[model samples]
Target: MTNPQLLWLRKNLFNTWYNSLLTIICIAFLIWLAKSIIIWTTTQAQWTVVQVNLRLFLVGRFPQSLYWRVWIVLAIASTLTAITWGVFSSKQHLTKRQIAVYTFIIAGFLMGLPGDLTSRSWLLLISILLAIGFGIGRKFPKIILPWLSLTWLLSFSLIIWLIGGGLGWQSVSTNSWNGLLLTLLMAAVSIVLSFPIGVLLALGRTSNLPIIRWFSILYIEIIRGLPLIGILFLAQVMLPLFLPVDLRLDRVVRAITGLVLFSAAYMAENVRGGLQAVWRGQVEAAKALGLNSLLVTILIILPQALRAVIPAIVGQFIGLFKDTSLLSLVGLVELTGISRSILAQPQFIGRYAEVYLFIGSIYWVFCYSMSLASRRLEKQISQ
Candidate 1:
């Protein structure tokens, strides 16, 4: 290469390399300074008392007898996660950093630095099960499908057996269901239920039937117009009036119902956007082939629409996960609610900073993972 060209290349490299290096150094220094200040304030200056309460944070005031249910739920969630990972994009793998962080967090939970409030052994067992599930998902994707199906069947059967056989499984009231378990349960159930409802609503909104379209549109608009808190209140207050007098839904059920309805409205809009993205020509082509409208949608349009909207769907799921915290307003003890409860306790009084910070970190991790997964799926779909 000519010296002039070489000089130009050198200049560009110098600018890029020096700029990146400077940015990294600045960030590292800022982080170090922040850490130093925090250490000084917490330990040396005594600006804040650092009372580490890991157990109450993880499991809340969950009773010992029913502690196994929490672990069972975790195991079920892990299996579902592994199934989803395998089914959606088995070729995609977790990064080394992700694996390390997950392992470290689970280990920290098991160690229980402050005290053993919850069962560390159960947490550790669940962690191991999760790790095993992830390994199975990564290495043997084909086997995961059947395993997931079986697990789901067995789980439901167990629930039924508990209810039917009169095993006297000490029922943990929904009010007592607090902490991470409550958050996960609410988010998971809401997302699962909302997805199908959203798809149906989206389809209805776009349908040729005038009555169906109007009803769906009205429902979506009304729900979207109202704040979630209002809807939650409605669920708690007005929902029972609509139902039969004999059936009274619990507070958690009402909260879940409200969440599902609210989320589905937003999800419908997202799916409608995706549906609109389908080329008119493609729909026409399907019609020209004598396919019915349902077939055209299900066989031809819906697949393309969903693929184009996977990122949006994931975004909604993340939103729903965060919104689960809102259930606290209705007396549901999710993660944030549990954190607040902890802060109110005599032992952990005035430790809002630590407790809230910890809860925030947990939320960040889950939201971040969902975002990363969305980006990965986008890349895969593009290719």
Candidate 2:
């Protein structure tokens, strides 16, 4: 039998002379581009730059002896992700395809790490353990679910101590934090902390209490009115001034604070839109059923409202992930900042393209994963 793909291509691409010509030219260009990229990457490009600077790219100037702390942080994250997937996924399984895709994609770059054979083995072990963790959580959700949130909360505090030190360990100043680790920390912390604040702000904005509503309105408007960079600058410049000298927040903490506050304001608007999308009839229906205001909102209104706005929430999360790069403006060296550090090195001078490309690719993969997850969630919900 004739190939199905070939028949479809003929129908779509060869239906007319102009269409056939266009398709041929496009195919030729793609092939040429692919060949050029392969040649450059394999022959001309100095990928050794990436391999040599792996530590700087991943963790910046963070001390090497303290690297185990990063592994523990990763384990905490892996467990939390497993539990989350087990709790929320329709299949009672973490989506293996997505996890595998990201794992291998990252491994491709990181596995080549020079002189890091043992660490690569550990990385693979962690990946396998994460899958096993997901299975354990999924199978014993009734027994395990209660501890999941508590574990995450504890892990949050533990991560801060491990990364920043000072909890029975040597104090590692936040100023030394940089690289992809810092980028991810800021993004994750901002998104996590922003959620509860956003929910409260959303509820307050919709409250019948005029004072509460107006105060909520004021905060959201004031924060949202300014550019995020301006807010970040203010946080960088102003936060330390108000604190007693001994209590001054570290630069990373200040950046996180600024990100959370700015993101919460935007997220409040997203949540408010979600809240608004709930029909008046739904509220009335719950009220008619003798439900109190809080019960009506909690049991009837919120679930539907949030479900309707999943895409918007995900979009905001992706934006927050990318916006974390803005911390470089305040002298915090996250991914983009780390890239600049690499470029500034005498040995890596004129390698701006490689460094920037690597940084951009990292950002792209993370943002793209969020976008894909959002779409998949929307599809699942609609179905």
Q: Per-residue lDDT tens digits of candidate 1, residues 229-266?
A: 89999999999999999999988889989999999999
- Residue pairs in clash, model 2: none
The count of backbone overlaps in candidate 2 is 0
User: Scored by CA lDDT, what does every candidate get?
Assistant: 0.78, 0.84
- Runs in model 2 lying further than 4 Å from the true structure: 1-4, 86-113, 141-150, 241-247, 375-383
Best by TM-score: 2
